[model samples]
Target: MSPGYLPFKDALDLPAFFCENCGFWQRHFTRPDSCPLCIDSRHVMPQRGWHFHTVEEARDRYPCHWAEVEPGVWRFFNDPIDGIGSSGYLIQTAAGNLAFEGCGVYSEDALALIATLGGVQVLAASHPHSYGAIWQLQDRFDPELALHPGDLSWSGALCVSWPFDDVLEPLPGLSLHLTAGHFDGHTVLYDRGRHILFCGDCLKFELDPADARRATTISAHKAFVRGIPLTPAELRRYRDVFAALDFTQTWTPFEQAANSGRREALTLIDTMMATRPHAYPVPLETL
Candidate 1:
């Protein structure tokens, strides 16, 4: 069986709501135009996504908890409102453990938890915006940094940084690919042993338990609505880059896991490429 889903209330103090139209839940807010997911516009609106484990309660919930999703694969959800934003993960390998993405806050307890496992050897972030507490993690583990060269400017004043080239062989079978969609240096990790792809925010998790058995794909629609840095043309190019990967299951740090068990990653890439461009305020009521 796959991992089960839990509400944000059980995990964090954040408000959540379920969208009847898409069957996705988002955060509840006084502003109708607020988007809790992308945290941008009302067109995308915030829907309730699966809540993972967290630490603390009330205003004290600055740091969140981590979970072991699959053997050797662990995920950490950071508390957003506290200003320590985005989720990250730790993957155990024969050499040592590797951490992907940065969290809002890194505590001694969290560092100890990672050290107790096997100790981290490499720290990587998919994009600059997701570079939560990378500097702190690096100071703790002092591991090799993995990031896209295109986003080097984003890592301002960081003493240690490395460019993500073709494929990185941090371990025997694990490879890190710089997909370059959501950001110039966005990355995804492919574990040959598990055939799982850790896509750091390049894709959003669309939750539908009833269709969990089927392959799931993300929509560029949200990106379109938010007026993100990427244009439709640029997005299409990024989609093409993601099309080259071979992954069975896709996991996002804070959302539901997608079963790309059968379909190729190219299928979703093609879908996004073919969709027609449109303006925001997409009448979510109609979608």
Candidate 2:
């Protein structure tokens, strides 16, 4: 089935409403609108839940792990399952800091690392599936939550409160582009200074070094998987979107050897897009 398209740019003019029950936010279109969380009967909704957490709680819950990607750019991984490392990033931008792809489960150690780096000023995700602990990060840092307009509908009630956008210049050295591959709203972060890309699930891992350029079968990382219903044609469109991006390095949220291997990572993604079994076949005209 074809996925629904959200007019995210249009929703920007709408007013923000919050739900007392679930602490989620939504757009107030009418005098008596229902709360997205509890669907409250009243029209007036609260706004406290958008980022519900004290500074201390946020610091204690979310821990950060750092990796020197190049020079000034660093990638922070949020270890979700304790031992199994998942993907998350902390880029030191001229505009303070930016976090790409957050983990749902975090620890105090992670939070401390984030704090040491002067805290996160903007929280963004590659796609809906990667939005594991975005609400938590927003609450802790109170940064603008930048998301791809294509995936805005996935935000649901939370979309009402946070500021959404198609593209944003979070920092002078950083820019995020919408690259629909794994999900329609999937995005990739580009670091101009270091030429590094933080790609969540748009690309898969190539286990074999010799066959690194070939697409291989692998299970989707839970933090980067989405439930969006996609047709084969849509998948092809997504692949096209990602192929257009000019990137030097691609990083995942895990401790995979592929993260540091740029050429291998790009080759794996290229093979997957060109030869993978599609859920729906692309039209010859489009190809």
Candidate 3:
């Protein structure tokens, strides 16, 4: 008798690999030595050293799970800190399902759950850091991966089909806009109908997460983990883009899915502003 489950490599017949340090997936016939993104300023080398894994290893290592963020939005993630720790989201619409933030691990079980949700028609992410095994997701679902040209060099795998710039509306009521704070070509997705902003790594969520629902205690950074801060001008770009978006709640990879505070998020750039020439943006003094 044959086994019920298909092997990882056999099931998803795609030439893709992932970095154990960052969890960003790339396509290659055979595993290449040294990941470029890991050595970049933003990611840097992990203290444990370079750890690479095949798609099969990723599957065996982590157990994938998901939860409903809203009626049409769902969060798919892998528990336990395997890599940088990221979650992918699925926004179901009549136009088609959009997989926001590529999920890291791919399994038969993961596919089954997605099938029940109308299947994915697109895969997109704000920046490289939040991108999991996107190449795998694209191969499995046969959806166009919406990526910006600014960060194309960071892609370990060449799976991008829909290269958009500035702004794009791939699906009905869903718009992708450039934020470009944490990483160039960093984009945020706005669900016009749902009024939620999927603001990837552009904003860092504080550890405590007191309210979880409100977008307080969040900070913008050039590199949050490395203490790198974005310049005042960069923050200005953030302000301009976010102010134009008509979102009530914000979703970030640094934090779990929640209905974030509207006013709190909209005014985040304002609150982070202060006297210039400081190491980081200082809160303004109330005179």
Q: Best lDDT goes to which candidate? A: 3
Listed per candidate, the RMSD to the true structure in angstroms reads 11.5, 10.9, 6.1
In candidate 2, position 86 carries an lDDT of 46
**Which scores better on lDDT, 2 or 3?**
3
Taking the tens digit of each residue's C-alpha lDDT, what string does model 1 give over 1-287? Answer: 11223343233223433222111223234212422334423234334533322222321445457777777877666544433256777888887777887655566777788889977787776665456655656656767777778767555424334565756766677778776656666677777777777766655545555764232334433343365434566557555555665667776544535454214334444544577443222211222
After superposition, candidate 2 runs with Cα above 4 Å error: 1-85, 156-166, 207-244, 255-287
Clashing pairs in 1: 25-47, 25-48, 26-46, 26-47, 26-48, 84-104
Candidate 3: tens digits of C-alpha lDDT, residues 1-287 = 11123344343454667788888776666786767778888776877776777878788887788888689888888875466778888999998999988667857788788988878888889888878866666666778778898888876464567888799999989999998877888999989988888988766554335665543355567886677877888888888888887776678875653544345554556655764312243221221
Q: Rate the local accuracy (lDDT) of all candidates.
A: 0.55, 0.51, 0.73
Tens digit per residue, CA lDDT, model 2, 146-247: 777677776753432333354556778777777565655677777767766676665444444464422233222212222233344544554454455555
> How does candidate 1 fare on TM-score?
0.66
Stronger candidate by TM-score (2 vs 3): 3
State in Å the error of residue 258, model 3.
Answer: 3.9
Scored against the true structure, residue 71 in model 2 reaches a CA lDDT of 54
lDDT of 2 at 224: 25
Model 3 lowest lDDT segment of ten: 278-287
